[model samples]
Target: MSSLLPRLHALWTKETLALLRDRHGLAALFVMPVIFILVMTMALHDAFMPGASIDVAYAVVDLDNSPQSQALVRRLDKSGSFRRIAVGQDLDAARQGIRENQYALVLGLPAKFGERLLAPAGADGQPTEPLTLLVDPTLNPALQLAFRNQTAAALGTIRADELTRRAGKLFGLPVSPAAERDWPDEIVSIAVQNQRSIRPPSSVQQNVPAWLVFAMFFVVIPIASIFIIERQEGTLQRLRAIGLPFGHILAGKLLPFFVVNQLQAVLMVLVGMFIVPMLGGEALHMPAGRSLIHWWLVAASVSLAAVAFALLVASLTRTSQQAVVVGGVGNILMGAVGGIMVPKFMMPAAMQRLAEWSPMAWGLDGFHTVMLRQGGFDAILPDLLKLLTFAALSLTAAVWLNRSSQP
Candidate 1:
């Protein structure tokens, strides 16, 4: 056992130094994933929480020009729900804004909006039509629901105040505290807001971490190529000739790449947490509820899963060309099935079902739970077990296949 440890350590040093000497390869290995994390995180963050940003854009066309319409607009403006509001009498411009920016919502108040609130019961006590709220169809469903609900509440508040004020003016008295009783329970009136343009869901949190898992697994290509190179150079035979055990040799080779994968994982996490914000992008914040130890365990599982996948590809391929195809194209195929390329939530029913069993999908789910969701080790145990199982099976398969093919 003592000799085994020393031999493995020596082999690990050899593999690591060989990788480090190849500056261009190491640069590609580290740099590409970092670039992807920064770019994808930046591109997709706003979509995840549409209103999280201070600058939510929308327009209000107060065609009523009355105290009621003005009050509603002022309330919405103060709510900080929107950053920039284009306020004018121009319905055309409001429509244009909704069409131009998918994130933008438009509110239009009709000319007789004030009169409708005060009319009480016209024939029957029917509720007045809702306010005109134009929303982009492509907007996120959650954001759409939130925007609609918020608008409803704001408009409801303004309507009640307007009704009370109008009743006081009609009764020839200043508005009083008892004015709350003046709004008849029978009067069912809400503003008439139109619904318009919207865009697609850009679910950022799911995507960034999903692609990060993909990039980690994609180390398959380079690692597989290295494995094939060393084998072709008869390095494995020389080690065997020098009395190195096959298991220890394999362990030594993978240990360095395993560490490399962990480093890559950290690089991606650091980029997301610190560098992204410095570059004018929103940084991913760690959850207060999660312990750092649990988070590291999840990170380690991801690295092991990725390296195991690479080892399997490396062992199965006989040449560098085959390794590239197996690692590159094969990982992409796995990624597609795993919801790395597309969100599982957005996928079709069949695909979503299949993704439930995908190893990459499990890895991503683990990350999303701890990093974004309020998850700890307990929340992620099932996924961790699945990942560990996958790693064991994949490594076993690689070793078995290599042994079977040997002359």
Candidate 2:
């Protein structure tokens, strides 16, 4: 046991020195993820917010010129979800505005909209001209649907008001035409949790841990580079001559890089907690007490999986260039498939299902369990198990590949 410990210590020292000397690899491991976190958090600041005002602008062409049509427009403006731009009443002008990229949407209220506001189909023996919505082709489909929903909601409120006014007059009940009552149907977002209610996740909350997981996996870059160089230089043969088992060598590489991943975790958390807020982003909130321990457990699990995966890549590739290409592209693919580059919640259902197979996704979900859900160890157990299982499989593959490649 003592002999094994000394041999492992030597291997750890060798890896540490090699990593410190690689300036470019160090930057990729540390600097790149920080920049990604800052830029992505700022860019997506309002996107995760529920009631935040959308920057998209829309215009309306009121062909009816009726009080009801005007009221509908006012209601939409009152929603304050989307910006309203003034455009001429001409339908052609609105269409041209869309073509010229002045606005992304234009709502057209057909003639006699107010007269037919309360009229049912076939009530007047005439067909009612439906509202027409013209949208720019480049606008996001989701935003288009939101606008359509908002417009429909506003129109329904106007119709209800007209119905109440008519019914009040018939029943001799007093009602004020200009006195609008605020409805209780406003949407409020609340995150369900074990403790007190917490705010829904912000951009920084999502970006920091996500990019951090990606950064940790990037240890593959340096790990593969070092492993390939040692193979070419016959360093592995010399270590093997000293009676160091393949397991000890793998163990040596694993600890140093695992430590590297942990250091990365600390740096990323500090950046999220301190640096991000300095740049006008929300400070990242980390779990406290027992929950913090659970968070670390997740981080530890991720480190193991990342280092093992890197070792597997290093073992499989013969040259430094091949290792870099395979490891680099492989990490990117895993990140894209996982929730690292894109939030899983934002992915389509099929894509989210695919993410389940990604090690990065398991790590991310574990962190989210601790940070967002404020979950206990039990809550994060599933994700931890997945990451550990991946690490075990990868390490087994790496050891097998190295043994098979031996002359």
TM-score of 1: 0.72
Off by over 4 Å in 1: 1-10, 21-25, 54-56, 93-106, 117-153, 156-212, 231-244, 281-290, 333-354, 367-379
* Leading candidate by TM-score: 2
Q: TM-score per candidate, in order?
A: 0.72, 0.93
Candidate 2 lDDT over residue span 177-201, tens digit each? 7545566657889999887888888
| Backbone clash numbers for all candidates listed | 22, 0
In angstroms, give how far residue 104 of model 1 lies from its true place: 5.0
Task: Report the lDDT tens digits of candidate 1 across residue range 258-359.
Answer: 788777767776777788878777656554544566666776787788888888999988897888787878777878898877767768999999998788
Name the lDDT value of residue 180 in candidate 1: 26
